[model samples]
Target: MKYIPLRESKKEELEAWLNKSNEILAEMKLETNPKKRRAIIHRNKSHWRNDDLLNYLKKLSDGKCWYTEARFVAEYPQLEHFRPKSCARDEDWKKCHDGYWWLAFDIENYRVSKPMPNVKKGTYFPLREPAMAVCDPDVAITRESPLFLDPVNQGDAELISFNALGQPEPCPEPAVDLCEWDKRRIEFSIKRYGLDNTELCDRRKELWVAIESMISEYATNAKRATHNDCKISKGKAEQLIIQLKKYLEPSQEFTSLISACFLSNKVGKALYPKLLTQLLAA
Candidate 1:
């Protein structure tokens, strides 16, 4: 998943919505009468119901789910409560109701998520205290026990890597505990979202196969020229490499393979400079 940057105008709009929502929540807190507080919450919920907020979030995330990278569309974008209102410890009816109502309106506690990974049954692993301690205090409660990668932090990507088969694996990072957690989270996310079961992996594999085919074809064409003349023309080899690199340039799947091949093989190393130039041009 790529890092998402919130646009300036979008940030301003979200802040404005938060300001309005907090005002209503503050009013609810002041109203000692139970009926009045209920009425205030009801009225405030309507204002928060505006779809613009969801749309803005979707745009910020490039239509991907916050956790799973699943595509989120208008009909299925689920409103996720980062801080779940249903804490097991709460006993008082009024206090429980208030907690639920108050959190629902808090912008910082909300995220536009897709249903699969977020709503999947039996995937709600409670966070262990040690894992929870790693979280920033302000947002720790929202991250239900076993920690997952923080979307805001680039370092999180170091823990996991996608294999050629499209399955996630722990990177060789030496921190075994963190790696184990990363693997568990990846597996949990896959099963919870049914990502492994879906056609997404198949589609990515197909794309990769196509890229490999193009590279193979270009290499074969160069080889045939070399055999015919007993020597490979520099210009012709450069042209073939350029074409192969073009295929790799537009695809993330192929780029990594191309780089690895260039670093490890003599033929690829010889041709890589031209390929790199072409790739950068594209």
Candidate 2:
């Protein structure tokens, strides 16, 4: 998960879509029956998954899921409503209230997601307190404290840390000194996002192993480069720096996990200062 800088896409097209959506929303709002309102949302949902809008969002994350930093290779990507549109459910799968129907067409509420996690997430939106939940579209959404870690918030991305085992965990106090609220949010989000599923964890572990080996080699080269006569070692160290930087590139999948694994160990930390200097210089 990383901070996605949300931007408007194809303004004229979006505005036209929004106008159509607003008309639908207006119709739904007037309907006093919840079932009819949900039906309206279900019927009108197709337009919001606009190709232009989805392409713009795909460019934002380089075609990776916003929450999991995963790319869907075998299947099509899903456009997730950061807040569920038709119905909102709690952690226990109990229906809480009507979803953010007003923002159904609003691009700010959209997230690029993989099919698996999108299905896993469903309509579940865990809040800090269910009592603080707002049903009225007029109410400021900031009044509700969401338990799921949002990728759109840069700080929320930092709250999750990966281990050598490739499992995601809430950053311990020693690592990042998280507050209890943040810790709980991270914990809940990990489960909700299905980030620790065996396949993902195994893939992450394999990546970590490869990266650790490269770091080890880099460390050895760095030590040899300390010798004034070792030009070959210095060149090798610089080349390794460039390679390592690729792992952290935004276009790469699971970059957040890659970075966490890089900084979690002794050798990586020992070389961190020099690595940053060379990466910038390179």
Candidate 3:
């Protein structure tokens, strides 16, 4: 997944929802009744379902799930909390009932994820430490850092790498040397997102093979044309151009894989200067 820049400015449109959530949380400060708290949390936090936030996020994501990077084919995308609203869990499903209740209403915690991964990640905000809750929402959030890498974080997004088969791996060669904890975190994210799902794998594989093959053909043809030898057919060259645009343009499907291919030095070197120039200029 590519880095998703969160737009705090857009959250203003969701002011009413945020206010409701904040009010519920504020009441939880003194209320000792768990049942009451849950109802309040559920009732108030449901403000997240508003069209203001949902439509805005849909537009921001370019209609892709923030987690799986899948096109949202269902009636609507699922509104996911980065941290569980009711409770948190580890890989073993050990629940920490004290979900980020305070931040449940906070727009910063919301992400547009697909139904599958969203349900899979349900209330499971695994962390390396058993973080104790603090009074301050800001400080508490920082204390409970999740093991699942967030796509919003550029560094977290970079942790994902791929092979020619298009299967996702935790790291590139450089990241292989990371500390055990960080490595485990990346692995968890991959599994959590089903990055290795056969269908996604097939998509990645197709992108990898298509891009690589086209680059090789372009390189060979361009070289031949320069040497006054037989070159690629004009129709074939036009097809290659279309493929390049399809794969390289912004917000393309499974673009992270396509990006991984483009960033490869070997692939870039194979692109003729003319083609490379056009791509770069775009």
Instruction: Provide the lDDT at 107 for model 1.
Output: 59
TM-score of each: 0.58, 0.87, 0.84
Give one digit per residue, the lDDT tens place, for model 1 in 1-282.
333343223467677777887788778667777667667766666665577787777775667665545455455687665444333111111222123445657655555666664565222333444333222223435445443443433455344444445444454333555645566665554554454644555654564555455556566767777777535554565666656666445333323333444433455555667767766875
lDDT of 3 by residue, 87-186 (tens): 7777888875467666667677888888777877777777777655433455746665678988777778877878789988756655447778888987
TM-score of 3: 0.84
Put down candidate 2 lDDT per residue, 84-166, tens digits, no spaces: 98788987899997788777777778888888778888899978888998888788888999988888777777788788888
Window of ten residues with lowest summed lDDT in model 2:
7-16
Model 2: how large is the Cα RMSD against the reference?
Answer: 2.8
Residue-pair clashes per candidate, as listed? 3, 0, 0
Model 2 stretches with alpha carbons more than 4 Å out:
7-15, 173-176, 270-282
Select the stronger candidate by TM-score from 1 and 2.
Answer: 2
Which 10 consecutive residues of model 3 have the lowest summed lDDT? 267-276
Per-residue error (Å), model 2, residue 73? 2.0
Highest-scoring model, lDDT:
2
lDDT of 2: 0.80
| Candidates' RMSD to native | 7.0, 2.8, 3.3
